[model samples]
Target: MSEIVTTRQQTPGDLQRLDEAPTPAEYLGRMLSDRPALRIGTRTSPMAMAQAGTVQRLLDERAGVASEIVGISTSGDQWMGDLSKLGGKGAFLKQIERALVMGHVDIAVHAMKDVPGDVPLAEGTALAAYLPREDVHDVLVVREGSKYRSLDEMPPGTRIGTSAVRRKAQLLKHRPDLHVDRLRGNVNSRIAKLDAEAQFEAIVLNASGLRRTGLEHRATEVLSTDIMCPPVGSGVVGVQCRTADTAIAEALRLLDDPMTRTLITAERTMLHGLQGHCNSPIAGHATMTGDGQLSLKGMVFTREGGKFAYAQEWDAPDRAAELGAYVAAVLLRKGARGIIDGIPH
Candidate 1:
């Protein structure tokens, strides 16, 4: 089906539900084949719009469903300071999720990493689908025409920019001399600072995020997992809808990649088990093994990177969550609990 992409801006608030809205089952049964355009809610950030557009395209191309991208300004977007002040990562999602519940949008799109693993899905909502995984790696963003092309190549006292404490901890653990300073803003503004000012030698960004924003060429070098472990749910786009919308949920599930789903299940299970706050320097990754088993690796680090714990475990693909919990158990046994408690998010 040929699809037309449409963008709409919606206000986020306690929208009054239509007094006589159709029943949940009727909403699905009413238009299985000839449905109204699905409204996809997302933040208004450039990366967010790009991610939502991708979803709009996929639903049209793969499922023959039409969609409209709805951009909602969220609290996280409005607040430039510490995210912890607005309730950590949840700040980014509150308004959009509320729109979904209010019937202002039929679905919500999110970068899975931004979703807090410790928090339950907002009441009455469910994660219905996930796009195929992208590169689950961190990359270096150095100034154009700079001599530094990679992490190790940079000299001592080199100042690096990043927002996530996980990245800071891992970077410090790798090179104690290099400085990992907090850098915030959308990817574009962050890169702008690298070029306009001499304050930062380089900045680290997600490889997948750069690709989604069509800025992959800016990546100076891809950091191997050995050097920089990724956060849980990186490189994945998750779709959320009302819990009672079973038909819509199943339709979206058709677009999901099973392998990616299992991997995320493992990674998120570990994250939930750890109960690590947004400030906690916890990292975990899951990948399919060559032998058809699932391998999960998890790490916990002090904010300063001096103390850490790591564990890796394997299980059948069907046991993704089991492998995740087992790995968390191993890390906790090795004193991850103490390190996690010491950090104040």
Candidate 2:
């Protein structure tokens, strides 16, 4: 597996000042200079920068363009206390998007799941490319000497940790017998906490995160997407850029995975249609079939675990957005509306 080569570290003092930051024109001038380089904006986290580097490399290879990264601090990174209790999913992405809009950087790379379903980029700004999707399942990283492999394998009253209401709702729906507790921190920190303390018997993390960090050794079991439908666009990478910048857009377009984008469009459309946010216990996944059609699957559940609904739909690639809306409507008719409306945002 290819890994992200860049590390997330504080920018050297020389590069920290905005006065030191070049204008969009200046940056593009540098790119078209005798030594060309594309600049990608990303949050300053090991996992995030790693993902950014992966995209940078792909853009370099496929577009015949060299690139470098500019690590930026996002609101989500500054205030890690309570995501939902703060300002919702937008906290994770707003600053980064603002940087793009302000021309601080030419491109922005993001984890698709962290991005909200209804991102309101300026009319001329859009997701430039979608990378190949990785494994979309959740995984249980159990404490050493623990016998639990799958979520079901955990005993009654077993304490599990997770920050996502969607994962908590889904896990409880299947195994109400287990205990779900709150968890926070970067990937390595979470694992260290779980390993060093007895607060939780295990913690649930995205398989893609583990794989990206080269920590797959900790996975006790990969929870099937069947039981744990992934959050929208869980394992994909998306690059955002100004729509008017046709050269940069075309450069990024080379890294776009058509199948991945088609599937993510359906999943994101379903999320947008349901008016779902990170606070809402919603999970959706869409797959592109061999025959070139898109198949969608999704679930919406209540916070109290009282009500739940699932829906699946299929359509040709061209109708990806329509397919997602139809599936959401189906789930809505089957009591999903009640669950969505009742859930706290």
Candidate 3:
């Protein structure tokens, strides 16, 4: 076996070398007669397990790789309070990432939206690929038999539970009378609370999560992007691996969907340029046109939802990151800086 290498900073030369390396199958055939089984690391939540299963299946089909699922608990899972207070979306990722960096697992699967805009990857680790995306819209899950069909139709002062600052701000912007309360837990727990306690009229959840968990029927209405733009990288699953492990990285690349990667790059680039975290009321989405141009739309809102700014841009697909940065600049010029700067760390 090769000695494991761990290095934090990657140079341009290192990336060039990896690009020149052989594909996983090619390398494996030449170096080892026996195929190595991989261990995939993920959070223990049912939704996380389902996502990991997707990646496992993809690897098996695409690269003829064998793998085992390894569930890992994270700080984000243990914390019961606001995610914002725990350093945003990355909280859910730290422990899983540690296992990957320490070689306890060969791969880390993540809900792309939970990946921080500024990813703090362990030494030598990189996001190798993205799976085909799921629905990129937010949905309103009202208690079964509720008369409310959508956010606009809900009665004034209707309480909606959600931990996402982006959802809370947008819901308030659309209907100032709606009460936004903090709601945290896995998909099942939140739904159970909504059904049994009746503390909230509805709750906002990612449509992809519901679909992944086989609970899509729970969503009363899929909120359109017009009403609620999704957070950056919302509907995708990212596969992370050590960059030094070219075999694993190449195998994961077999699952990468080019269009999904392009869209998420633009969205994440926009978030990175704006210096926004999960706590910030930031939302962005990118789409590829039939003509090959990429369109990016982004929004930033005041913490209180009293004010907001939005911007959009279109460019060649190859210029996705540039388009994201351009949109961020446009929003900043429209006084979005005040709103973003005011968010608590």
Colliding residue pairs in candidate 2: 124-243
Model 2 lDDT tens row, 1-345: 998798776666745785678655445445555544767999887888899989877865566567889999877777757787667777878888888888888899999988887656555789989999998989989987787777767789999989788889888888888889878777887888898998999999999899888899999888888778899989998999999888788778778988899889899889888877567888999987788778999899987455789888789898998999999899888988777777665
Taking all chains together, each candidate's TM-score versus the true structure is 0.89, 0.87, 0.89
List of clashing residue pairs for candidate 1: none
Better of 2 and 3 by lDDT: 3
User: 1 or 3: which has the higher lDDT?
Assistant: 1
Alpha-carbon RMSD, each predicted model: 12.0, 12.9, 10.2
The local distance difference test score of each candidate is: 0.88, 0.83, 0.87
Give the winner by lDDT. 1
| lDDT-sorted candidate list, best first | 1, 3, 2
Per-residue lDDT tens digits for candidate 1, residues 52-144, read 998888776666667899999998888778788889899889999889999999999999999998988889998888889999899999987
Name model 1 segments beyond 4 Å from true. 1-35
Candidate 3 lDDT over 1-345, as tens digits, reads 999999789999999998989776656534422645799999999899999999988877777778899999999998988887788788999999989989999999999888888756678899999998889999999986678878878888899999788899988888898889989999989999999999998999999899889999888888889988998888899999999988788778878999898998899888888887667888999998788789999999986578999898899999888898899899889988888778777
